[model samples]
Target chain A: MSLSVAMPDRRVRATAAVVVAAVLVVLSVVFACAVGAVHIPPGDVIDGLLDRSDPVTRQIVWQIRFPRALVAALVGANLGIAGVLLQGITRNPLGDPHILGFSAGAGVAAVGLLRVAPEVPLALVPAAAFGGALASAALVYALAWRGGISPVRFALAGVAVAALFTALSTALIATSKLFTQAALAFLAGGLYQRGWEHVHQVWPYTLVGGLIALIVADSLNVLALGDDVARGLGMRVERTRALLAALAAVLTGAAVAVVGLVAFVGLVVPHIARLLVGSDQRVVLPLSALLGALLLVLSDSIARVVVAPGEIPVGIITAIVGAPVLLILIRTRT
Target chain B: MRSSARRTTAILGTAVAAFALLLTACGTDETAVPTATASAQGTATAAATQAAPVGVTVTDLMGRKVTVAKTPTKIVTTSPSALEMLYAAGGTAIARSSTAAAPGIDTSKMTDIGSAYQPNFEAILKLQPDLVVADASAQAPLAGQFEAQLKGVPVVFVGAVKYADVATSIRMLGLVTGTAEKAKTSADAIDATAKQVGDAVKGKTATKTLVVVAGRDGQLSAALNDSFIGDMVKIAGAQNIAAELKQSGQVPGYATISLETAFKDNPDVLLVIVPGNTPGPSISSIVARTFPNLNAVKNKRVHEISLDIFLQAPGPRAADGLKELTTFIQPDVKLGAAVVPGY
Candidate 1:
């Protein structure tokens, strides 16, 4: 194994990767803001930012493009860290927030609420989704526990729970005729037409989740060493795993709450981060967040322009790009 | 072994061909024709002329040629837009699919035949409609199911995706309903309205417009070329920012554009078309609060229009839709205000 080899240079590599990723995230935000269905010259984009003299340009920058791009970066950061936490806790490379069925649980509860109460105030629907995700996470945790949770058992339970929750959500959609179009689109996972109200909704959870992940960063590093080793090292492995998973659920729930479900970001971003820097959770976590933010912001920007005035699903763009990046990583690693 | 496998393949091919033939032979044209005797609530308006049936060989929007024994007495529209077109053509139906409750049409006596996209074949058949019409442009994949359900009933599809298609489809509906004269009157009225819009903006400079449909899902998508609203925007003498984009999948001439691109295009006129019963702050608020620099918002030109006029059977009141678009895009051009149809 290259673990011993990778260990020595990891600190330096991680620091370098972090700087590179941070730079990329900032650049992605700028790129997204400057380009859209409407074209503003790069100078005007910069001028719109610093000068604010051109009313139209200023509005496009500050009001529309800026908020959208900012929200995208924020969402990326949320999903990115969530991916790191979930993957670390489960010791499953394929693991992400959905490993706890957060998305499906959020979907079921959101659909049920939408069907039962046609008017659950648009601003507050994310709360309903967050509630659903927590509930599903609880369910997955309860079922996966047999004295203590193993990664395989927990993942299988999560998959099953996700399936059940997804089915229940679809059943609600199928049976309810009064569900609004927004209600359905909310479940499809895109930031299309999302604005500041959405930004307001996701901000608290992102702050809380990101901070929690940072505080628990050392715990995650200990937990990544198998449970026996972690326990021997005086770490409360089960409790730490639970806390990390819960934090991931919160982050995933928050992301899903705002954009419904953006595919591949949470699943792909962490591994890509680890591949860029070594497998040190401390380094990988922030790197994942930056990479996730950069990837989504850039993908969203492309989603806006690829068809010009028309936009395709952002998930499609991410998957198209994400799958290839992941495949290359797998082949090169193999 | 290979010969035996070949023999099985030949047998299976024969069976498939036989099945196809059987499906084709399941019903004859005579059985598909609805009886002219009993007319439904809306169809009775045509009863005065239905007593003497006339046969017309007409090609539908999908290019399927259909022969009608007489004007259909019982009619069902699967989509809201088609129902609107049917009403505008001065025809009525005995039943409609679930989402067909548009303004002005009375659905109290109409049976709900499921949804326009997945209409209940049994319910549609129970009505014994002489003719069934659906929006082919919206649900072309469902066409075969309707055709397969035909015991003798002729199912016609209309592509009411544009202002022109609305008038053409209305004229076709007139042909199917023995209301050709009535259809002509309504079509001419719509055409006259178009002429009015054209005349008002005859020599005016067109505005570069962006029409984004605010979906019920809180999504904003660009209304592209050939779309109902896209076409209306063009006829009103405005340049569509999403112009030249081809129709895609189920959405036809619309594509989801990011808010950045939408704002970047900086349309002179921006129209947000909300395609649902409930209106939310997702779009209006975003445009007002988030894009203050947009020419539309800065000049107070970001207009929010309901789905009824935009999505209701394309072209039903398109002349009116065009008129409104013209006034917004070319304010100096004076076009008379038109009624907001039944909705």
Candidate 2:
């Protein structure tokens, strides 16, 4: 007399992961919204969201905290997709959009633009960042290509390029006394004094980049397998890899444009998603998005609470958590 | 492998194109030669625009001859101390280097160049200043570098050590900028204000006042005897905790001290000057929180003041800062009667 257990179908498993991830994302948003310089209760946050509160509380929750929380979630999702795409194209577990010079490129360009045209509308920052990221990714790709793109060569090139761009950006900030302190905080990556204007600025890029990433999801899956195998499966391997890389670059650039160079989410989220769900792009991509949003929201919450009235940089919190996790993965792999 | 190669080539080509585009975009906005000439001409024209031919040539503390035609039509000042002195000396100049958003200056005409530490060289050049005034003690080392770039344009470096030196700086800047009478009036006002503040705090059971400046990474440096603000605190009848420590040799600032030494001193009235915002775990807050045994925190006598007033320039506003200090140390003292406006 044996009880038999049946395995869940592929669609059912994917659906379950998505549903669970969505719930976690919602919880993360709620948690992040509740913690800040002025702590709004979870009930107040909901009330504010539904427009059922008094003017003052409603302004705090809706106008201030909600935009920041939403930006964090969107940035996290963008980073997750970008990381997944980057890893998939490069076939390197350590690959991240920032490590690949995309964010550094965007940062340098954004700071340069701001310096040259201080009066330029802030809405143009994302476009400038996108252009910068695209340029950087291109540079890394070119430098690594000795005839064909080698994964190790690409990673090495990215590391070098990222260092170069970050150094240049620092130099620019140091020389100009006018924006040094402001630029320093911006480069450090925090969401202080940001509002709905910033949210609206980055949303279009995030949406477009995310949509592009989803469109190239199949191509990314094909490109994830070794070049020869992917080509053998009748996929235009080179074209697919290039498209996925471009998609990653756009997403990364847009996010960095909005919030200076935030580290770890892109690299860590995808790897975690891959571990939980198999390396299948369809499951990995969506799961990574959920996990990315959750990680950032939690990190931001910690940033708000740990310092209380004064908030620590979100980048610092992410590095503290992500660096250890990354080390464990490397140690295990080795 | 072939496909990977093609993909790599395409990516490389695209990147090269993007790099070229970025260079081109930046190159288009490069400072034009005519703009440089125009700025120079603007400085020249500023001298001609003055109402009087009030020509004055004075050797600054650093021994550089600064010639000003009718005072300064467009003066750019770095360091709040220098700005305060200039204002005290009857010079209506623009502050080009201010870190704080609220500089406490009449912002109608003053344009901030961000922070003093990182003075925007480009913005300074754009301002086309006739006279550039700054502290000789702090900014003297960079005088040659600035002079060479300005190409004969004079930079007056005013050296102020004690509160008394602030008067000397005011007189010197006044002579150079053709405001000697105004400078004397300003100097007298500052002295009177100091005396008033001093009289209020006198005989009021002196509390062991500790003057500390916050360094990078939460480090604290005690202002010793003979240091600008240290001497002022003594004049105001507060004990100098870091009197034994020698003056800072590397930079013309306070000698750095360990937290252990600071705790040992354990001053009754703690006065802290931080670089920027007075946030949590700052030098003042940290001292208050970490050492419960300290007298200042226990008695609620801890005070945090702006670096500009107390630390930066000990010129005309030194009295104002000292006045604020007296009020903080002894709240019941009636010092307001002594503060005659202008004097």
Candidate 3:
């Protein structure tokens, strides 16, 4: 699985990985639109996509499956980028948004609002989640700051914050019991019953976070070469790290707000991308985006049809599919 | 996203308030549902002169044939609905689940046996003497172990998920407790209520309805034609819009339906469950955001009903639930008295 490449050959390989992943994402979305509790023929799927299908098929494909698939892909891509940024800034191979308790923070706020004051309009949920995620990131940074932030200490603080927030989220669910199903669905992470509204909600974060990730890639690349060397290279080490962590938090928050806490995409997709395209942030970031979209879209498709009518959470599918694939890639790479 | 997202055991544990009422044509027969049948072996008058006490053989909800070899004086009920049936049948349990509450029964004196899903087995055994009545879906899995732990005490599983199951459960408990006459009176009340509701709404065109059990964050699961609430909706002359949907996984009678299906079905009346203490999103607001064109939104027929009356246990208050449904389904039809329970 390890492709030993010459310096010039690495660029071609990374481009190929990105293209292949992009193609897989499109194919998975099309496949997803074609199959569901109600079976739509390939012709009908295409017609539905083009807004020329019969009323029923159009409703199922355009209104239900299409938007849901897009939401899953967007969430996946955002989380994957977040993972790369977090891992890069922390210099920890195991870093992801969840490791920093970003999802937990967001989950607590969103679940609490839904449980306690369910009358709150649906539009406000994403904003609350975003606020909670940023607040938790700030808390972790403050705890880690003795003189300045240390990567190990920052990561440790994130885990503690995440545990605390996760407990609070659970407490809300157990105590309220009214929205247990809704809270559980969100916590478990899925694109169930999602429509264009969720797609509209998530895409802005993807666009902004992605642009920021691209802009900060070189700084991340510099920071990877040890903190002292990065400083010697005229990179503002602490500021860059904080900026990247905040970017990761925004991305994680957006994804959680829309689809809840989908696991593995943030944690595993970046690793898979690094294995395929090497550690250069510029290459890893885009490659991770494509790979993440492919992974989530494919997993969500499987989630929709595996049990049919009734769906398992997309998170479960991601973990079941992601862990084995990552293991095989790691085993072969070594 | 609703019931299907949950593991079978988790759904059964939490949503055990109702199970499949009757195997509907759409697809409830998928689960191995054992119908409850109580056979009183020998006439009540003949047992008066007999030397031995009269025993009754009853097929419980789990398909287990339990023989009550004498009237159970020290009975323990695990679920709230089971306790309701037991109490209605004139049987007083020595211990009851913490959630068990009947209309007039003062459960303050009874020993609490924890939740219906996870009863304190040790506590139950400490107070138990003769028999244990448990919910079929939630606690039936523990029956073999429980009976073994109790050393020959029979555990009769009763799940009143459907409207009719309430009567069946009461009758079974009546026979077990030697209070068949009292059980008949209570059980007949439910039938009379259903008949009255049906007769009131008979001439009117059936209203198309969508009964949703709201999960947090606007996630909704619909009650199909086979659910306890679904039975009431049918009796009240409303055609359940989710009837065509099949049961998903182990969530016996309810199915997770997509919003598109809901929008397409275009139910005339949309009933949302508002669980206690949480004044969930107004149906008008929800409709405006999601499905403005829906008839329910246009007609202002989207109502938020009590979860206890509509979604929870189908116990002694089942008749009350029927009367409540009739008011919603056919507004012109008036009952003699208000049916809302105080609790």
Candidates' chain A TM-scores:
0.93, 0.88, 0.95
lDDT of each: 0.71, 0.69, 0.74
- Model 3 regions lying over 4 Å from their true place: A1-5, A177-179, B1-317, B320-343
Specify the poorest-scoring 10-residue window by lDDT in model 2 chain B: B22-31
Candidate 3 lDDT over residue span B6-77, tens digit each: 232232222211211110110223211111111121333345425565667789877888777777889898
Please write out the lDDT profile of model 3 over residues A142-243, one tens digit for every residue.
898988888888888888998999999988776553325556767888876566667767777776677668767768888889888998999888898889
Q: How far is candidate 2 from the true structure (C-alpha RMSD, Å)?
A: 15.7
**Fraction of reference contacts reproduced per prediction?**
0.00, 0.00, 0.01
- Tens digits of lDDT, candidate 2, B1-343: 3354334334433432343243233223322332365468657756564545556767777777666665577887776667777777877776545542223457566776545543433345446677888767656545654653444345888867777778778888888777789888877777787777677677877667778777544656778777788878877777677777764323333666676777687788888888666456667667767888888889887888867667655566566777777777666776664342452
**C-alpha RMSD over true interface residues, each candidate:** 26.5, 16.6, 23.6
- DockQ values per model: 0.01, 0.03, 0.02
List TM-scores of chain B, every candidate: 0.79, 0.73, 0.77
> Poorest 10 consecutive residues of model 1 chain A by lDDT?
A174-183
Model 3's interface RMSD: 23.6
Looking at model 1, residue A80 earns an lDDT score of 89
lDDT tens digits, residue span A123-197, model 1: 567888888988888888889899998877888888899889888877776544222455566666666655555
Model 2, range A197-232, lDDT digits (tens) per residue?
566665665556655565556676677677888879
Which candidate leads the pack in DockQ?
2
